[model samples]
Target: MKPRTSMVILFLLPASLFYLALFLVPAAWAFYYSAFDWSGFSDTMTFVGAGNFIRLLTEDPVFWRSFGNTLKIIFVGGFFTFSLAFLLAVLLNSGIKGKKVFRALIFMPNVIATIALTTLWAFAIYSPRSGILPNFFKLIGWEAGTKFLWMSPEHVFWSMLIAIVWINVGYFVVLILAGMDGIPLEFYEAAQLGRLSIHYGVWKTPAHLPVGLRHCHWRDDAPADCCSQYRCAPPDEARIPAILGENP
Candidate 1:
């Protein structure tokens, strides 16, 4: 073939080989294994057709229950994580006092190991007999005992949800904060000006203003006046101003 095609093939060959070896091989092996009656480490293997899948579908209530529980946890955990991250991002973006300290405090949990965090959560936070929750209950005039906590299956799920939320909130907060940081300041300034004009009744149809016009409000007073006559500014000239403060 041509020299360029040869060079492209050479560049991609190693990665393609690695993927075949690591992923394709294992997946093919699993498909083969699924049709067998082999004990995973046994020397003799027998083909069992679809026996395993048939049994799983017909008589596996426990497996199905566990799968359902996993889905529940994912939905609940994702909801809490996304909501808290959005709120945290908004708080960090606001020009509030001491926001840096709060952001650091929220993000500190992400640096910790998952196993270590789970261990601490199980022993220190949810240990029904002498855990922190029990102590707090006693201090608040409630009976501090095992009966009120982890002893119940219903309560255990809530306890797990709390731990999952605590561990993941920081990471999601950082992601959303980064997204917020990437939004141009001019968009916000334009939004503010749009609101002001609406309040003073100068612009009757604020919603009808082009997005470019809304963003032009961030320019210096001179440029802003010049640009105000037009509904929208050119994209090249409508850049955001430099951020004035340190990131929290």
Candidate 2:
């Protein structure tokens, strides 16, 4: 083999092995365990073949609700996240002052741990009695907002969706902003010189503009007061069985 080919294999070898061990092995184990009925505390796992899957699909109302919530996170959460991120990216890219400061402020949440961020939302922001929202509403004499129960069953799903969006929007803004910055200044100059419209110039940039125009597609969900990916979060009465136990 060529020396360059050998060097490429040496670089990729560790990552390939890491993926196989951490992701592939665990996923396979989860699939194997899904065929059984186990409360997760017992020594013996009962072999029920497709019984568990059948119950989840046809008989479980909680499963259906969590499934619906997942869909909401994919669609609704994605919409808000991308829209806000794109807007912020555009504003920042337009020669805004203190761009670095604004970028750091927006991305600060991502610098902190996810679990810590969730705790802040649950206790500091969403707590009805003494939380920020309630206190602000009370100060403004908005009685309904003061009395709102954000963590309550009826509102918890939407509340979580909002939190998830806030946590992820910053990272996407950075992504899209980098792409926008790659676009040549000549395009904008052409627009300013009346050789092209601003819209035409931005839209017509061949390579880099497509990266900026691409929509955010985030699949991971945050864990705040409940599991996002597992569909075990509340608003559904009962918990879904932990058969597979948090698969990626």
Best by TM-score: 2
Off by over 4 Å in 2: 38-47, 189-248
Candidate 2, residue 175: lDDT = 93
Clashing pairs in 2: none
lDDT (tens digit, per residue) of candidate 1 on 193-227: 64654443353335743454454443334344544
lDDT of each: 0.73, 0.74
Q: Which ten residues in a row have the lowest lDDT in candidate 1?
A: 237-246
Where is the poorest 10-residue window by lDDT in model 2?
236-245
For each predicted model, how many residue pairs clash, with residues at least 3 apart or on different chains?
Answer: 0, 0
Per-candidate TM-score against the hidden true structure: 0.67, 0.72
Q: What is the TM-score (0 to 1) of candidate 1?
A: 0.67
lDDT of 2 by residue, 160-184 (tens): 7888999999999999989989977
